[model samples]
Target: MASAPPAGQGQQGAAAAASPLAPSEMYRNYNFLLRLDSTEVRFTECLGLGMRIEPIRYRESGVGNVVRALPGPVAYAEVVLRYGLATTPDLWNWLKRTAEGAVVRRNVTISQLDNDGATPRINWNLYGAWPCQWSGVPFDALGREAAIEELRLAFDRLDRA
Candidate 1:
């Protein structure tokens, strides 16, 4: 025959089961910032921050029905940043220089902040990034929307910190 648990010990297990588990620290996507060469830039949207590795498949003559894949060159995707039109002409000037045949490469960093919105939890560093494309906001007199400019950047390498 098994003995029963102590008077308070049985209630302790029940209390723990009734209580909900504490959630881990999770960051919000909206709480992030973008920087270009140490200059903080305010952007409403950022996309295409990723990389891909191409795999090269190989087959040996003696191996039967077996194929091996080898890692190939890595490609970094272009990042697109969108911001509302402002009086500042820094972004415009960068695109203008690229259009004039002078490619000005800059380092870009995107950081994900914690709940405080000030402390950086993760950072993605893009090296040798340059303006590849720029689009002006569409003029919509009927629509009540703020003008937003889009800038596309091509980077040679990407690192995460």
Candidate 2:
């Protein structure tokens, strides 16, 4: 049985709608990938700063590192940071200061070989850890450029506080 079409619609319009596989000029455009929120995310500091604001994102894996040490392992790591430092020490300081509230990297101690016994066991003790690391290189490199813009806003809020 044939169904009646709209009062003013033409046969061509109906034919276009009926064809599922037909290519059409109408399509969704998705050029931009990043979805950002400007809303302030807050954190409380240990030094009685009360609230620290931050913008957060679940960034890609390459942004951080997971390094295994020799002889089984000495320490494991996950570092996140912004890109803007001349040396490791400087970046380390920035990480310590900026991300103290958001991240941590605990240091694990490995015992050295002693003359007393060739057992040469690792101490495997827990040392202090830094929660945040400078976001690693390839992570920053491979990710969309929009990341820098988002990260800058987040860090700026951190600095203002």
Output the number of the lDDT-best candidate: 1
Q: What is the lDDT of candidate 2?
A: 0.33
True-structure lDDT of candidate 1: 0.90
TM-score to native of every candidate shown: 0.83, 0.18
Per-residue lDDT, model 1, residue 36, is 96
Off by over 4 Å in 2: 1-87, 90-100, 116-119, 131-161
Tens-place lDDT per residue, model 2, 42-160, is 11111111132243435456855554333332223321223332333533553556565654333323232333423333333323434332344345656664332011211111111
- In model 1, how large is the Cα lDDT of residue 65? 88
TM-score (C-alpha, index-matched) for candidate 2: 0.18
- Model 1 stretches with alpha carbons more than 4 Å out: 1-24
